[model samples]
Target: MKLLSAFAASLLWAIPAQGQTDPSQAALEAAAMLEQASIALTEADSARDRVRALTGTIQAYEAGLAAMREGLRKAATREAQLTAELRAREKDVAQLLGVLQTIETTAPPVLMLHPSGPLGAARTGMMLSEVTPGLNAKAEALAKDLQEVQTLRILQQNAADTLTQGLSGVQDARTRLSEAIADRTDLPRRFVEDPVRTAILISSTETLDGFASGLAEISEGEIAETDASISDRKGDISLPVQGILLHRAGETDAAGVTRPGLVLGTRPRALVASPTAATIRYRGPLLDLGNLVILEPQPGLLFVFSGLQEVYGEPGQVIPEGTPVGLMPGETPEIGAILSTTSDGTGTDRSETLYIEVRQDNSPVDPESWFRTDKDG
Candidate 1:
């Protein structure tokens, strides 16, 4: 029995820690993504289309950071589970240790001798052989659990640095993207925006419905018509930004205000893009809805997005699908806050909200019906 215990201990000690042998897949993928984003950033400086290149870099960084956050969350959850299991088996472990110690200290001659005689001693030896394998298996399993707990702790500690780099890279990409958009004057124009008419329209309208109904009055020239029609693609479009659906249209808020729009919970400074190729009918501050961008995908259809910190593109420019439209307003959480929130599993990291409203033929429609809501941000 003592020999068996020693062998088990040696095997356990020989087993490598899981973290050293098999790092978290999510973490590895995230690191790869971040590395690619860094390379993209460097290449964007010389790219012919800096806006497009920077946009891709920002997206890569976002994906990497999201993966890292998920990896940390899983690691934290696994660590907690292992800790709890260890605590629950504390008495069992103590008893197992005591048994091992007793077997180690006992003299082999005495252990082999049975009071009944040679027959009892032979039976006892058989019983010991039968139990040894079970004990060794349990000991090895326990060792693995303990090692995994230690590994998870190390993984989380190392995640902070990777997350910081990802966050910094994304911010830099966003800044460059903004500069690129500003310097861009090559996008096709549908019409020149008449600021005076647009102001009059805003001043004259008290609600979104009114403003949208009069969108045609602000164009200074004949609007260039495009064949772009998303009518067949209704109910299959992606959301303008990566986020969680907070509230459906007509859901009342804490302030008791109800509006016909879908509310999305997004992270701070999250990128917002156009889901389809559309002409920018309007882009600016309007009413009490911070910064807004209105896109006319077709003559009778309009997509309204509000609660932005920065808006992109000219009022009458025709932008391609997936163009960066704006950014959500809020300070990015620090590394410590992100890790704390992830471990706590409160999902409070998404602190900003984006409001989306879809209108067809001058009537409000459920945004959910038009946008795919099953995807994770």
Candidate 2:
């Protein structure tokens, strides 16, 4: 009788717990996840396109400045030659004036009082008429040279100002680009699993990939239906972060460990975003990776963004594309921790690195082949 009573008590506790799990609510959560993922993916692509366009503008400005410099060089040469010619002409005109003055004071009066009288004066009048026109022509040439030099100087100044303004604009665009990326924080959560399992998994995992794979299995939740899958957009997505591609999949690192993903070098405190919409499966620090976040865009596919200095969003959260998920470390040795272990000959000292991994069914794949560097390719 006592054994039967204990069995009934256990059944009662199990029934309510099972009843609390609602099927319709789970489906709704899944639908919202899918819709938000689609929107986030679109936003991610647009962000990349904007960055590309801004980079192109900066390049165009640089080219224009180069052309202007070349043109200015030629103009300056012309000005130099014109200035030298003007100086010579002025010297010749000065000598001509001295001679004309001597003739006016001495030759004119002498001609008027000469034995030949009026005939000599008539000859002097004709000479004076010819010299006066030559003097007027020299004055006009000098004025033209001065005007040309003044115009060249003005043009050079204007070009310098224009180039300065263009550089300032480029700097502003760069600042705005960083700001836009950092401001993308629109993640909403439906649930978050307990951290004990995550802590245990991190402790036992040998590799980050292995740690992420374990997370994939443990972080499974309600099914979400989307219009498209991440697999459907292969080679049509943007990189999650804005920076130079420093390493590709299968590349060995400085420590001789080979990882199967792309590495990007980004600025300090740079905000990292998702390349596509996804549900946060894991967000925390690991052994080597200081702070990390894992995203489940679909059931089998997982994106591990390691090397974060700070993280936002929780597991089971649905994040839109281009949403700011975390921040890069601004200070070193923490900053140094995020830098690329492998150099593809493209990394610099001013930037830190973001390690990205894409896993499908627990297998790593090359992200470079998946991300679209250009809109078409």
Candidate 3:
């Protein structure tokens, strides 16, 4: 859970040190800022979604390529079988030719019109009838083998073409995702140019408590506003990252310490987005946590997320729903991690966990109470 200390240290000291004189005016300004942030967040989200969709497409293509290669292998095996059969048929024909040669030194027409007489003619007719059926059957089998070989070759070529196209599609998706990440203009900021104040805040806070107190003082001047309250969207908000829910609020661990929020196991380098538009409460390293972010969906409710390798927005910024806030640390999957929506055994490779805390009136609340999806532990 993010207490006063983590909140203070991670956030920028942009809120005026002195309190605002007109609370109503400050609230109006805050609302206006949120509106701007919401607009920017919407634009950023659209771009991010496009990139995410492309990544999914690339992964799907990779799965398809694997299947196609397996099919091609099976087809090639069939072709080999047909080739072997054709060679055996050819050997049988050669043996039959040798027998025919030993039977008579004359051509087929001569044998049919032999100079010997009716007895010789009747003997030739019986021999011819016996040999004809075998020759015709051999010819028919050879034709079928040749046709099958042609079909397999065609299938192999088509599969190769499909794999090539799939590769190209994946590359395109990667390029677009990179471009979307680079575009950050749509993000709205709460901090203007206060480098000196930020530096002083960083230097002054040595302990978590001091940091929290300092931040509380700084935030006294700012106002909080949102279109909807956290309580208003209970059980309908999407998760910040795609993954399996590992734990739920009040769940105890091996140490017998009960958790105050949800723990999710997700893909490496997975994109983390804001479940809803809210002010950036905190964004930086917290004690024992890698990189953490806290959001204020409304004045009394705080949503805390930690375990990111890189962070995007600042403490004073307002972010849109679905706007990417950070990425988990680790190498992205080669075929892109599977993000199956269903509980089927399709995606089972998630290896990282994100800690999510929902606090109301500074007390930890059950996050499952607000999520649309069901929780695990």
Candidate 4:
């Protein structure tokens, strides 16, 4: 797109004779922009795929941990049951022993006084002794079983401890995978700037669908407009936008949907990325957000969406449906105002503008998805 000189070129009051430049040039530029956007789209899609795989791995670990937890629960329940039963049996054994002792001691005394009698206390004592062996054996067996239960409790504890450790490890791995996939957001930005050369970049995007596929309540970012930057690696790709939210989950009201978002950076130039590929980690308050968030996007990258003036506020690109990302760097008083529809056939309507960012983990990503496919491409 031809940028107007900051100071409108001084007008020469001469009559024009040559034909006005054809609109074809603009179309050509648009075509080029579309081509570059396509490449970015492909990269974003691939990154998403990798993230999904990592997420699945994490889920598997969680499942394993859940199973282990269930086992521990069962073991604990069994131990409790065994202990209750053992206590009951011990009480019975104690009562029986006390009665047998009383009888043996008293009966012997009575028989000893009549030592000469044929049916003497000595004979009775022998009978009691015969039964005592079996009684003692029964008590001993119960005691042994009780001790076994104690041993089982200890064993179960050990198993539970081991499983807990394993579960923690799986969780750590899952976190790493999630962070890795998120970091890919930066790839498209870098690829777009140099397409064939650059290794790292930070840019903006809009216009493409599923670009924020996994995000919650995502909306389109800035739109393509005459005054906007409308930059393209090759040509013109323009599409305006309005507010968008990733992880599009939130409460809706008559005004609009209040989706959840992490409003990063009250500080200018800090709104590098949203939750998709980037995040904020702060040990101290982010001034307005109150808490610091550390976000790991993956591939050894960490993004912190901090310096936020507010934490529970909103974020992402803004513009009419076709607004270009990062094109209108300044404020637009015509936020909700209508503009002529650029599509095939539609009446002019209204729209707003929004900024957009893509980050892999905590770094920024190029935002080219928010533009139209150039007619030529």
Candidate 5:
């Protein structure tokens, strides 16, 4: 029983937050929600359609990862090749250094000893040409080659370092793309389902009904109801919207079959119409009200008209009385009166008629008293 009680309470709250607050706030919130839903659904479709884009991005990332790995492999290979080449160059330099040391230590003194005289070494050169004629030049050339190889090693190390950093950046990008794909898949649904966020959607239907009722201020600071006098109301007197003008003033408990008024095509957007405008309270693409508008002239007194071809304005737009709100685009019922024919027992012809209603304090009220000569509606 306790669980059931809790369930019932929750269900009640989950239903429309009834009563009234600021009409503009309610209308704006509802329309905004609808618009948001529309946009979200549109984005969802785009995302679904562009699943291929995400797929392509994923594939590209994979390919790039492969290419990065291959690049790193090549860098390592080049580094190894450079190391091997440097080792071989070092060995050649070491062998040349040894030969240079030997030649430096032994060549000059021996040549001096063997020459007939220091100045007459030309004769000794003829004898020593096979051993040491170009030994000094060979030592100098080997030293230069060793220095060049050391410089080449430094350059190779820098190149390898740069390649390593590049590979890391590519890997990071791949991870980010994967996360983005997941977020796009799940975020919108979760955002929409959040209880606090979804509460508005749950209340949408009832709120829509209130919106259909045209009163802007259902309850003032403390008044159960307040009626704005005709003097205070501002509307296009010449071209009032032609539709059933539902009246609440001077109405009884049961006002039925009131004359239908011709609600014009002009109506304030649902979000901002004055209470007196019989403004479309709530509108949507519904069955009979096909993009219908609800107008409330007084509390509990609502005029629901359906089958409008198009809607104008937004949730809280205050419009004049004669604004063309919409068209009767649906099949309306026709009135018929039976007549006794001389030849036939009875005959009846389908004739056009209008649906009408009046209410007071949210209850139906008689329209015969409130109508201005039955011509204003």
Candidate 6:
């Protein structure tokens, strides 16, 4: 019996622990996306449209980073739960180890012969037979948990390098994209911008409403009209950037100010695009608001985006849907900061805000009604 117990323990130790649950799917997907982004970066250098190519690369990096962060958060949470569970089961584990030690040390003849004679020995054998399975099962479960904990730790350790590469690749792509946009001169323009009129309008208008109302005054010539209309897609338009809605239209802010627009919380340097093909009516610093882009998707509908660090495209040029318009203001976080935020799961990495206001025929409308607020990207 002692030899049998020893053999069992040897077998348990020799066999690798098989986790009951699958590895994190999010982590796997994140790795795949990061790898693709790496490949895309290499291919972007030779692409015909460098701007579009770099844009795709940047998007891939963003998705990979987001997924990686989520995966790390889950791993951290799982590790904590397993640690707590193991601590709680300390007594059970100690008893299990004691039972194993006692079995290994006891003489087979003495273990078979109980104090009360043959009947006692038979009862003891029966009890051992029933309890042995439970012990083995508990040992297996413990092994699986330990293995998972080790795996999670290794994943987190290796994630730092992967995140660093992803962040660097994305920044490089953004720089290349900006240069490509600057060199771009093929886009068609509907009208020429009169800087003097624009300056005059800015000086004269106190509110956004007044500035928007006077946009036509800044046009040097007749604005070529297009039949472009997104009325069919009203109430279902995707947001121009990947972010969470921080404040709703007419909601009061910490500064005791309320506006008829939606504020989006986004990660640093997040890309802002046009949700639909539209004409750029204005693109510059507006009263109090930072760099802004005002797009007219249709004759009566205007989509205003504010709080950009750098604006793209000339005013009066019509850009297609998903065209890169601007980038949010802020610097990319360090790997340590990213990991800390991931472990905390507080979503504080979204440090930049983008203000979105939709106007219909010179009247401000609820941006939530026009945008799908449920989407994160």
Return the top candidate by TM-score: 6
Q: On residues 1-377, what C-alpha lDDT tens digit does candidate 1 reach at each position?
A: 45554544543423335464243566677778888989999999899988888888888888788777877777777788779877976867766666667666889888889889999999878867776666666776787788878888888888888888888899999999999999998899889999999999999999999999999899898888777788888899999887888888999987788999989988889999999999999999999998999998888889999999999999999998889999999998889987886734454677899999999999999997788998858
Better of 2 and 6 by lDDT: 6
Residue ranges of candidate 1 with Cα displaced over 4 Å: 1-23, 98-111, 343-346
lDDT: which is higher, 4 or 5? 5
On lDDT, the leading prediction is: 6
TM-score ranking, best first? 6, 1, 3, 2, 4, 5
Tens-digit lDDT track of model 2 for 1-377 = 23323322322211113444232233234333333433433343356454334333433433343334335555565566677766765645465445445545775465445356688667656755655555445446555667868776665555444445444543454454555434544545545575676677877898876786676445446434444377778888887665666677888877787788877776555557777888888888877877888887777788888888877666777876765567677642221222212112233533678898888888888776678754310
Q: What is the TM-score of each candidate against the true structure?
A: 0.88, 0.47, 0.49, 0.27, 0.25, 0.89
Give the alpha carbon lDDT tens digit for every residue of 1-377 in model 5.
23323322322212114573422233234333333333333343346533333333333332332232233333334445546654765754454456546556776767456435755666545544533434445444444434544543454344333334333332343343334433443211101113332234434435333433323432222322336244333232222232333333333323352223332222111111122454334444643334655555544555554444544433333344443343333322111110011012111111112223344555544434344434432
1-377 per-residue lDDT for model 3 (tens digits): 12322322322122224552332233233333333433433343355455445444433443443344334444555567667765765645455444445445757666677568877788767866665555445445555557768876665554434444444554454455556656546666554424455456657777433444444344424444445566677888888876778777778755686678877887666667788888876677766667888787777777888899877665667777766677777764342221111112333556678888877767777887877556321
Go through the candidates in order and give each one's C-alpha lDDT: 0.84, 0.59, 0.58, 0.33, 0.37, 0.85
lDDT of 2: 0.59
Name model 4 segments beyond 4 Å from true.
1-49, 91-155, 185-377
Query: What local lDDT score does residue 254 receive in model 4, on the 0 to 100 scale?
Result: 42
184-280, model 4: which lDDT tens digit per residue?
A: 4422111111221111111132312222222222213321222222223212323122222322214343447442322211111111122233222
Q: What is residue 299's positional error in candidate 2, in angstroms?
A: 1.9
- Which pairs, if any, clash in model 2? 40-321, 184-324
Ten contiguous residues minimizing lDDT sum, candidate 1: 12-21
Clashing pairs in 3: 235-370
Indicate the TM-score of model 6.
Answer: 0.89
